[model samples]
Target chain A: MDTIDNLADNQPKLVGHDHVAQINPLLPLRKWLYSWLFDPGIPGNHQKAVDRWISILIVANLFALLFEHVDVIYEANKHWFHWFDIFSVAIFTVEYLVRLYLAPEDREFGGKKFPRLRYISSPFAVIDFLAVAPFFLQAVIAVDLRFLRSLRLLRILKLFRVLIPACRQFVKVNAGRTFRQKVHALVFAGEYGGTLHNIFDMFIALWVVVSVVAVVLESVQTVHYVLNLQFVILDAVAVAVFTVEYCMRIYSCVEEPGFQRAVLGRFKQARTPSVVIDFLAILPFFLEVFLHHLFDLRFLRVFRLARLLKLTRYTSATSTLTRVIVREWPVISAAAFVMLLLVVLTASLGYLFEHEAQPDKFENIPQSIYWAVVTLASVGYGDISPITPAGRAMTIILALLGIGIFAIPAALFSAAFSDELTKEREKLKRDLYEMLADGVISPDEAAIINREARRLHLRQNEVDHMIEKARNDRESVADLSGLPIHRIAAKPEHAIEHYKALLGQIRQLGILTDGLQFEQLARQADRLTSSELALWRQIHGNHQSQP
Target chain B: MTDTPEQSGVPLALAPALTLADMSFLVFLAAILMAVVWLGRIAYLEGVKTEVTKASGEAWVQWFTEASPKRFTPGFEPSSCAGGASPAGTNGKSAGSDAGASVNPVPERLWEGCLESLMKDVEPIAGLRNPFSGKPLMFAAKCDTDDRSLVGAMVLEKLTPTPPGSAVAYTTSSLVGADIIERKLQLRVTVCDKGAYPIRIAEVEF
Candidate 1:
C-alpha cells in the first residue's frame, strides 16, 4: 500500500495535457491527428482544411448524384462519377474506421459494449455510414435514389447546432452583466444565434406545430384511434411547457423598457397578441378539465389548434403577412365593405326576382342571403339555385362581379407585402448603422442589435448583408466633417426625425453648423428638397431660439 | 300542370354537397402554406453574411467587460474589450508558428482601424469569434473613445432603398453608410486569431 501511494505521488502530473497514449512514441502525432479530425481551428489549420474538404465533398457528392440522374450528363461523365463515388466511399470508410478507433475520446460513445458499435449507432455516425453505404450497395446490388448523398448533406447542415453552443460559451464567461441583460441576451436578443433563449423558442415553436397537427388530426376518427394516447401525452407536455413559458414571460416583462413596471408590465404583456395566443393555446386543456360537468367537453379540444398562432411569433413569413394586412388595411377594408354591400344588395334583389318562382327555396330575403354570399365570394355551394329568368340573370352578374371584387384584397396584400419586405431591410440597415456608431460592436451591442433584428423578424443572412451594407456606407460615404452622411440621408422621410435629434443636440450644446458642418448639411440637403429640406433648415436655424 | 309533375330526374336524388376530395384539397392547401412558412423561417435563420466579406469565413462579436448600461459606459479603455489575451501586454509578441495565434495589437487595439468602428461609434466593434470553433477572433479597426447616444427622435422610413427586407412602419430610422454601400464596393475585413495569427480566408463564392 505504501509503494502504491509512493508511486502515485511520484508520478508526473499532466495537468495541461489531455488523456492520450503515453506509452506510444507516436502519441503526439496521433493526438494531433485526432484534433485535426474533430476539432475546429482557423481556416488554414489541418482541422479546417479537413472540414472544408469534407464540406466540399458533400456538395460534390450531391452534384454527382444529380448528374447521374441526368441522362445527357450521365452518358458523358459516367466514368468520372463512378471514379468520384469510389474515391468518396474510400475516404468515408477511412473516416468511419478512424472515428471508431478513437471512440474513447468521444464522451457519449466512450462506454463498453464495443465502442465502435456505439459510435456506429450515433446519429452522425449513422449518417456518415448512410453516405457511404449506398455506394457499396450499388457495387453489390442496385441502389439509387432510395439511398444517396442527401443524408451526408443533412449531416453538414447540422453543423450550426455544433458551432452555436461553442459560441454561446464565450459570452457566458463574462458573467458580469445584469440578470435582465443576460435574459435579454438569451430570450430577446437576436444578434447572436445560438443562445439558451433562442433554443427554447425554437423548441416551443416545434411543439406548437406538433400540437396543432395532432389536434387537427384528432378530429379524424381513423387517426384518433391509433394516436389518441400519444395526443393526450403531447397535450399534457405542451400545456406544461406553455404554462411555464407564460409565467416566465410575464416574470421577464419588466426587463423591457416599455414593461418596466412590476404589475402593469405583466398586464401589458398579457394584453399583447403573442401573450394572448399563448394563453389561448393552453386554455382549452384547462377548460376541458374544469368544465367537463358544465357542458360536452369533446369540442373544447378544437381550440387547442390556437397553438399554431403562437408559432407566428417565431416565424417571419406569418409576420410578413401580418404587416401586409396592417399596411393595406385601408384599401382592404374598403374592398371588404364593398363586398358586404354586394352581399346584402344581391340577397335582396334575388329575393325579389325568385320569391314567386321558388318560394320554398328562397322564401324570404334572409334565406337568399346565404346564397348571395356564396355566389359573391366565389365559393358557390350550389345548395340553392335560382330557377326564374330574372333571378338567373342577377346571379350571373353577381358571380362575374365577384371575380373582380374578390381579387382586390389579394392584389393589395401582395403589393403591401412587397413594401413591408423592403421596409424591413431598411430598418435592419439602420439598426446596423446605429449599433455600429463607434465602428466597433461589443457583445452587448451585438446582442441588442440582434434583439432589435429579431423584433423586426430579420434573419441572420439578411442581417449580415445589411451589416456589410452599413460597413460599406461608413467607409465610402463621408462628408466634409468625416461623418457617414449617406446613412443620415439614406431615408428622406425619417431624415426629419434624425434632424430633430441633431438640431436638438446642437441647441443643447450651443453649437452652430457651418463650414464643415454646413458642408455636411449641403450634401444631405442636395438629396432632399421640398418639405424635408424645409424641416431640416427650420430645425437647424431655430436651434438658438429653442434654448 | 301539377307542381309535383315539374320534378324532372330521380325523385330521391341527393343534392350537391362537400366531398372528401374538397376537404382533402383544403387540407393540402393548409399543409402547403405551413410548409412555406416553415421554409421561410429556416431560410431566414440560415442567412450568412458572405457577400460583403472577401472571405468565406464567419465573424462574431464578443464582450470582454461585464455589460454596462449605455449611459454609464466610460470611454472604452484602449484594451478594455479583449478577454484572456490582454491587448496592453501584446507588444512584440511574435505570431509563432501556430496558424491561429494571439492577436498582436501592439500600438492600437483590435477593432480600432476599420469600417465597423465608423458605423457604430459608441461601442467599438471589438469582440469577434470563429463561427466553427467559437474561439475569439480579432479584426483591426480604428477605435476612438467617442461616446454617442440617440439624442433626438430617430427618423424611420417607409422603406430603405439600400437593400430588400422586411418593413417597419412609423419608427425612428437612419440610413447607414449609404455612400459606401451604395457605391456597391466590397467591404473587405480581415479576421485573425487571439495569437495574432492571421487565418487564411478562402473566398469561395457559391
Candidate 2:
C-alpha cells in the first residue's frame, strides 16, 4: 500500500518539456501527456494515430502469441519471437508507465493524496499492470508452463476495455436522449430521421453476414489449421461487436413501445423473439469462457451461427416469414403433428412387415424411424429399403402421403407470406397518404413516412416510389387542388383559400368588377338597399333561387 | 516412451504446480493487464484513433489456448471425489482415537485449507512429493468416516518432468467409506507411474 501511494505521488510532473514553467517543469509535461493520451478534444490527429498504432500492436502481439504455441513455428522463429516479445513488452511497459504517471489527471482520480494509487487499484489500472507484469516476471522468475499460458490468455480480456466506450458515446445523445429512447430508435425501425442510427444498424447487419461466413468457412480442417489465428481474430472481433450491441439494446430497451417502465421494459424486451436471438448470439461466447472445461466447447462454438438470426430484424422478408409462420402456426403445427404420426405409423408398419424378412435391418422401432424420416422427408438415402411386398406397398403409400403432408405447411406459409406482403405494402401506402394529407411535403412529414417505410423494411427507392405515388394521387384529386374554383373546402385554412380562388375566377369571367364586389353584395344582401339589389340582379341572369 | 506400452491418444501436457509465491505473481500480472486495458479504453473513448484497429487482441489469446496441443481434458475434481485429503498418518488406532475426540452425529470440519491444483496421494518420484506434504517426506494415514465416497487422501496432481514412457493417470474418483471409523481402514499404498500429473508421476492410495 505504501509503495502504491508513493507510485501515485509520482505522476508525471513533466508534460510539455519545452514550454515548462521555470517553477515547475512537471505540470506542463503532465498536462501535455494527459491531452495526448486521455483527452479526445485534441484537434490534432497525432494522438488518434498513436491509439491506432497501439491497437495494431496489440493485434500483432496476439498473432505473435498465437503462432508462438505451434511447435514448428516456435522452433523456426525462436529469436524473432524473443525479440518481438521484448519490443512488444517494452512498448506496453512504456505505455503502462505513462498511464500510471497521468492517472491523477483523471477527474475522479484527482484531489487525493494518492490519486495514482487509486488509479492503479482501479480495474483498468490492474489490467495495465498485469499486461506488462508477465513479461517482467518471465525474465526473472520461472513460471509453470500452464500458468504462463493462462497469463497469456489474459490478453484477450483487453477487449472489454477497448470496446466499452466506443459504443458509450452513442448512448449519450444530446441532453434529452434517454438510453431507452436511443435503444428504441436503434433497435426498432421507426425513427424520426436518424441516419446514424440506421447506418449503425446496417453495419451490424454487415458484420453479422461476415461473422456467419467466417464461422462457416472455419469448418474446413485445412482452413481451421492454417488460418486458425485469423479465425480466432474474426471470432473475437465478432464477439466484441456483438457484446456491445447486446448491451446497447438492453440499456435503452425501455424506450420500446410496450417496455415503458424502467426495469420491466428491459425485461420484456429480453423475452422478445428478436431480442432472444441477439442474446443467444453472444451467450455461447460467454458460456465457453465460464464453463469451458465442463462441456465440449468446440461443439458449443457452432452456436455462433445463430448470429444469422439477428438479420431477421433488418429484412422484411425474414420478419415476414416469421409473421406468416406465427399467423399460420395452427395449420403448420397440425401438419407437423400429422407428419410425426405418419413417421411413427410407418416405422411400426415397417417393423411388422420387414421384421420377418430383414430382422437385422429392422432391429428395433427406433432404428426403423431413421428409414421413416428418410422416406418422409424424401431424402431417400437408399441406405435402407423394404424387401417384403407388404413393406414395399406400405412404402409407396407413405411416400405418396408424405408429399401432400409436407406441402401443407409449405403451402400454408406461401399463402400467408403473400397475404403479409400485400398487407405491408398497403400499410406503407396508407402511411404515405397520411403524410400527404395537406398535399404539401414538409421535412418532418417526409421523415415520418420514411420511418414507417423503414419499419416495414422498405428500401429507400421503394419508399421514394411510394411517396411519389401518394403525391400523384393527391394531385389527381380535384379536392386536393383549386384551378380557379376546383378545390373542396376540406379544411378551415383551405376554405378561405378556396373562396378567394372562386371569387377570382368569377371576376375573371368579366361579370363582377372584382372579388370585393362579390363579397360585398353577398354580405349586404339581407339588408341590401335598392342599388345593391339592382347590381345583384344584373350579375345573376340565370339564377333560379331568389334568396 | 520406453517403459510403458505406446499409447495411441494425445499426450497429456504439464500443468505446473503453482506455489503461494507463483499465485501471488499471477495476481500481480492480472492486475497490470486490467490497468493497461482500462487506460487503453479511456484513450479510445476519449477520441483516440483506436477505433480504426478493429481487433481487440482477444482472438489471438483465445486461439493460443484453444489451438494448443497441451489442452486440459477432464482430469479430476477433488470436491466430488474426496471430502478432504491429508496423508495417511501412523495407524487405524490413532485415527480411531481422533474420531473418539469428536462427539456428534453430523459431520465435522476436521481441518480446512486450500488444496493445491495438482497433487498426488503420495510422491511416486524419488526426490519429489506432494508440496502440501512438506516435500521430501511422505506419509499415509487413515481417516474416521462413514461416508463411502470420502477419500482419505488422493493423488490430485502429476509430477514435474513427467516420465515420458509412463501413461499419465489423473484421479477419477478417490473416496473413503463413511462408516469406517478409526480402526476400520488402513493406508493402502499404490506405487504408480504415468498417473498423476506434473507434481508426482505415481500415487500411494490409503
DockQ of each: 0.00, 0.02
TM-scores of the models, in the given order? Answer: 0.44, 0.45
| Winning model by DockQ | 2
Tell me model 2's lDDT, rounded to 2 decimals: 0.56
Give the per-residue lDDT digits (tens) of candidate 1, residues A1-547: 1111132233222211122223433556645556546644322235544544775576567656754665555777779987887887788788777877777655565556776788878777776776676666666876555455454455444344344554455254324444434444455533322445555676688678778888888777544433434556567767766766675576556777698887898799889988898899877766665563355455677888888888777667776787788878889999999988888899999999988988987899889899998998889888898888898999899999999998898888888877887887687677767755555554455555655666666665666567668866764453313334554565563466567667677555435444345535545667645475455556556542221
Model 2: lDDT of residue A203? 67
Q: Report the number of the highest-TM-score candidate.
A: 2
The A-chain TM-scores of all the candidates are 0.57, 0.56
lDDT, candidate 2, at A195: 40
Please give, for residues A1-547, the per-residue lDDT of candidate 2 as tens digits: 1111122243222111112222323558887677656655544424445655766676677767877776656887899988987897788778778878887777768788899889889887687678778777887999876577568665555544554554443333312443344445665554321444655676698789878988988787544434445565566667667766776676666665687776788788889888899988877766655553354355777989999989888666766777888888888889899999999999999999998899999998999999998998888999899999999999999998888887888888888987988897887687767656655554455445555665666665676577678755664554524332223433555567566665566445635355456546665775666676555555545341343
- Candidate 2: which stretches are off by over 4 Å? A1-195, A452-547, B1-206
True contacts kept of each: 0.00, 0.00
Native contacts kept (model 2): 0.00
Point to the candidate with the largest lDDT. Answer: 2
